[model samples]
Target: MAKIMDRLLLLVYSIIGFAVSVVALLLVSRIIPEREAEDWVESLYGTDRLLQGIVITVSVIILLISLRFLYVALRRGNASSPSIDQRTEFGDIRISVETVENLALKAAAKQRGVKDLRARIRIVESGLDIMLRTVVDGETSLPLVTEEIQRAVKEHVEEITGIPVSSVSVFVANIVQTQTFKSRVE
Candidate 1:
């Protein structure tokens, strides 16, 4: 919602600036006499008169307004509709790897079979890759538990964050025993 408002504001500003510039240009052109073009130029440049001041002020204002419109349009274009080259930033803007890893860890921990989870993130040539190591209960079926954990984590991470997860490698490092000795004996 806020983003839409910002884009709308930029568009309005750009339109206003462009309209002002066009109006100023038209007004200036109308004020200049047709037959005395050369004399007007010579007098304006040669003598610092009122007409010269008006022309200078209008020209400066038009130039500034045009530049402002161009800048706003460029900025809004980059934000709302970005090109292929503008999609990826050169330095420190790669957030997919970290975001995917964090989401994966959180998802895996929430699964029924998963007792604990450890996730590792790696950035490859293709995209973001995630490796999750999950500990399950000893009573849980190994294959089924691992598969469920993988599916749950992958779905959650991909749905929440717009990052594509290349791979989810689930390693069952150990099985956790929640039953106490007394409970077992009883």
Candidate 2:
């Protein structure tokens, strides 16, 4: 998803560059008289064919580079999740990020008053960062619930995976409403 967004942004920039280059060329041509502009261009490169070819070559190169970027972005990610590369005497060990997310979700769900849970794991300079967005019962204390969730997720994931957790960010997106007897009676 992020790769697509980044490619779209680059595509926009490339289009803008192309448009600006064309506009600038037109503006420069208009600034000089037709014959004088022609002479100036011919004088710069000696032959019009060589100048045009050079411009076309550069433009084609730019286009091809942009196409390459788009192609890579559209392609699927390498068939692997983020993990630490550890080489021991016997063999290599890898601990996937998917495992961390699943573990965090499980730990967060175990907390009191949690109604729904989502977790995302990111590789950071310090270590892994876990972000959890959750829905909970409205009657629950937001701070307490969030705190426990953060602690549980960080502790559990780090303990199981043997990877350090830099931080756990909990976002309480929504709170569910529970029915009361008085409201139903009224």
What ranges in model 2 sit over 4 Å off?
1-51, 66-77, 182-186
> Whole-model lDDT, candidate 2?
0.85
Least well predicted 10-residue stretch by lDDT in candidate 2? 177-186
Cand. 1 TM to true fold: 0.45
Clashing pairs in 2: none
lDDT, residue 57, model 2? 79
Q: Can you give the TM-score per candidate against the true fold?
A: 0.45, 0.65
Candidate 1 per-residue C-alpha lDDT over 1-186 given as tens digits, one digit per residue, 9 for 90 to 100: 856755665676678678768856865787645556667668888876898888888677657656765775687453432211114455433344455667888888877767888888775555456788877888878988788778888788768755566677888999988876655554
Question: What is the clash count for each candidate, in the order shown?
Answer: 0, 0
**Model 1 weakest 10-residue run by lDDT:** 78-87
For residues 70-119, write the lDDT of model 2, one tens digit per residue. 77769887668787655789998888878889999999999999999999
